[model samples]
Target: MEIETRTPAEQLRACEALRRTAEARSLDILCELAEHYEVSEDSLIEHLVDRRIQPVVPGPTVSEFLSLELAGLLECTPLQAAAKLYSALRLKYRHPTLHTAVQQLDIEPHRALRAVDKCAHLDASVAERVTTGWLPQQLGLGHTAALNRLDKLVVEADPQRAIERERARRKDLDVSLWGSYDGVTTLSGRLEDLDARYLDASVDRMADVLTAEHPGLSRGQLRAKAMGVLANPAMALGLLQRAAQPALPDSEAPNGCLGPLCGTIQTPLHKLRPRLELAVHIDTNAVGCATGSARIEGAGHITLNLLREYLSDIDVTVQPVIDLATVAPEDQYRPSAALKKVLLLAFPTEMFPFSNRATARFMDFDHTERFRSGRRRQTRLGNLCPFSRRPHRGKTAGVWDVKQHSVGVLTWTSPLKYVYEVSPGGTRLVDTGHDAWRKLDW
Candidate 1:
């Protein structure tokens, strides 16, 4: 009945062992359940697999495995449980070593995912470090700091590639907000170094306005209150429109998205002017069919039947895959303005099942031709995957080695070859990028 004391490092190591044990047990139960339902155990312990063979279609990948009881056990909504299951399978297939390391490192699943994102495009040495849990150990220091070390390691491994990757990573910055159950709202999110620095300065400057009322406010409190001020809709919007102006707009215009004045600007958004840029690509004829759906780029897909309720005065950008042209596939890297206009056409709302984030920008302009080794071929060598944004990391991590996957579609009774039959020399829309999201766990 005696408990021995352990050092912090020993405790950490013990915790990691416990985490791995729990994960293994969980996978065992899930796999057994899958067998009971005659399902693929692939959804469980998917990270252990070397290569991923995606589940067959024409049937449910989720409903067949997920139920109310399973959802409750997992502490998530039924849809969320399904999404988690699907995403686990996808990410595991993409990063077998990383997932294993995550369990071994006792890192939270989501944080481990972000680590994978940061380290996905590194040299073999860096990847080997990741597999052995050397890199992830640094994550305990802090997310940003750990990522900085990973970046430095990659740079040391390959300076030129590091520079190119940094440029791409810097170009991609996003700010988002989510609500909590506490009734009180919260504002927090990931921001890159440059933007974070700029926001810090801006918040400091704006907090000065509140100095008279609360002279006792510390720098942190000032920054917090400044964030509250920034939360004001009118203040935020006017700031955007006038960020380029001579002087920034102050607390003048209404503080809401509604008419001239309102407090809760967030609520009346569905009624007020549209703010989001929604791009739809679904055929008009098959509007309300279950088989038919519309992809709202950047947000995923919705049933075509809900089109009336979902869309009203929304402006849509369309990019249609056409029936061939004088332009060659190799020449079509970045679409020209005119070419983009012509490319806008109706496409299937979703390609892969459980794929929710089918954005126009995420589709792959995949070449059907096989890749020939050497001798000056259009190998898509330098190009990055629009979604993962990883390419040429001394291995095929971001880039799949397969030149083409033969996905058959049944037209009637017979099966047709190739993934999609885009008018021989033409192109067709594909959601290859959105099988899993970059920032989102699901």
Candidate 2:
């Protein structure tokens, strides 16, 4: 039981056992709850297989209220609870062999669930046949290999459906901006094949042009700069025209010429300007310091040198700094802009257990203690914390018991008596020797 004495391999085996046990326990509970409701047995209908009558694969359909009740206990939104319940039911009944393997700690539950997900659209009879036939061999394969095998089985079972799924997936294209970290934002998405190739070629072309001028920059760094260069239509068009000409040797290329045609292109660079709003909060003393850090609104922490590099050419509109010490508690329920800004600076992400790391700026500033109409200073910094809409609704519905023990420290007690401590640092499960969350035997 002493983790310090255990070898790394032993620790990993212990962790694997605990993870399987937890998932098995969760499936048991979900199946029990699903049985409480009047589950439809349509998919459970008996069918003739190899001259014997057998029950087809089945899954439960629980009442909507059950999901709401489980949401608070699970510390997740109702939609997530329902999805988990649905997946658990399918895993338990539709793939009984895999389910038993999970319960016996022979295989990971996620791998089995991945099989269930891949074959979910097939008919109950087909799904049962596929899993029952392939479960024995695929159980020992690695995660990715197992999933690939399952996908092949699904394609073999229902080729028409697989074709349809492929066509549908190909049509799903989108571009999105994810969170910023270490002074860089991530842009990711799925794109059509031809468009992706075109974009890739364009980026390489731009990166090549940038590399001719900035020899110190690496290829990856030049490619990143190429994305920004492509954003400007004037610069993009000029680069395209220059690309039509013959290639310049590395030695013959003009150094320090970032603009198109070695700064000879006459097109005005500012004709189509890209506007961006970036909010950066810094301490007064750190403004001109040699070594200090600042917090970008969407991005996390950034060093002063990196911040200067990011804002070197961009126009910055500075706002007067508010003295957080002087900002007093307000009598109104709604918090002021300054107070909200202070809270965003304090807590960068929403203050809910198992939250999706939602930015604090987009969350609802809810009072930890309910606001009374006539109470003075009810909506204050100490009493307010940001929560996403679903978590806020769950709290409002009295499903969870939330107690703010001190400023920036809160404890949440679920209906099932699962305790979680939430603070500015992070969230952690509180072990209170409760039966529900007792220490597992590893």
Candidate 3:
């Protein structure tokens, strides 16, 4: 245990191993806590129902509160204790795969517990599928991937409910501004796509004009200024008019034209419209069916009928499908725009394990096995995966290693020697704990 003279790499490995051990032990404690807090079958329901009695049921049960004993034992807030109890009970009784994985110290405790919490609203069968089927596949990925996958599963399980929720959400739409002591205010709200698009265009137009006035400001700063300008409709309108004015020769006019806003003063801000390019993936069986679900680009999943209703008011152009299986990989190192689009569509999210901050479209298409120049057929579908900048750097720096098993399927090894497999279907923790640690020495 004495590490005063140990190398930095050795110290890092020791710390990582200890951390994994601590996390595994923590899960064991939570399971024990759940057993301790479980409602006794012998206890009468009438006793708990009494108005004078404080609710003793653990977890997020509507009327029940965490028991004082449980909170005291955990040395945490009642809410925190309750949440812990909830995750433990759900994992042990319901999500067996997650339960075993955590017990074996394969997956992170927080990640597994959060998965339980996200699936709290699901029914028995669907929730079972989530833990036993879908979760095991996505376990290698980060929390955000798990969250997004959970949402997709929930929508697919009950598309009608998702549609209803979307409808109810629309009814709750409201815009509000919060003022802060930092001399700045935050404006945020959800709006219908049509209205939001128009507003976005107006803001961009105004931002363009503001750019001329504030030459040193970033585009984002200019946009923020534009939002303030829009608060005064008359001033905003006059500025838009001036911005739209055609520029005369430099000799005739003192100032040149505004950037994108220069031209056609006749096209008022109100007349501006937004064009959207939307792609929706639908299951073959669910085509033209109310029960089927469709996943929209950027958005998760929705019922087929919900998608129809959403597009009803808009002008939609249908494009022929490009069969990904048939799309052959090009020989060149740099993929063509058309091929890049296919790749992005093929893997919508970044390929790195424990990463979901960026979509594939915003990521670099990394060669799974380092691409060598003049190598024939090196830049192929199975050999390529999307990687974010940080992970890409790590991979290049030899801090992390990757092996592509097949198209969209990859296995990665961390500096700590923990192994994870990631694919479009989900992710899996291939190796971990003391066994993996011991093997490193062997």
Structural similarity to truth (TM-score) of each candidate: 0.36, 0.72, 0.42
List, residue by residue over 185-267, the lDDT tens digit for candidate 2: 89899998989999999899889877877899988999988998898867776766565454545444446343345544665
lDDT of 1 by residue, 382-440 (tens): 22121111111101221222232322111100011112222212233333333554783
Task: Using TM-score, rank the candidates from best to worst.
Answer: 2, 3, 1
Every candidate's lDDT: 0.44, 0.72, 0.67
After TM-score superposition, the amount by which residue 162's alpha carbon in candidate 3 deviates from its true location, in angstroms, is: 3.6
Arranged by lDDT, best first: 2, 3, 1
- Give the higher-lDDT candidate: 1 or 3: 3
Best by TM-score: 2
Q: What lDDT score goes with residue 353 in model 1?
A: 19
Model 1 spans > 4 angstroms off: 1-19, 27-73, 77-117, 121-130, 133-151, 154-165, 180-183, 190-195, 231-442
The digit string of per-residue lDDT tens for model 3 on 54-135 reads 1222232321322222433454434455566666767766676777887787777777777777666666556767667666
* Residue 124 alpha-carbon offset, candidate 3, angstroms: 2.5
**Judged by TM-score relative to the true structure, which candidate is superior, 1 or 2?**
2
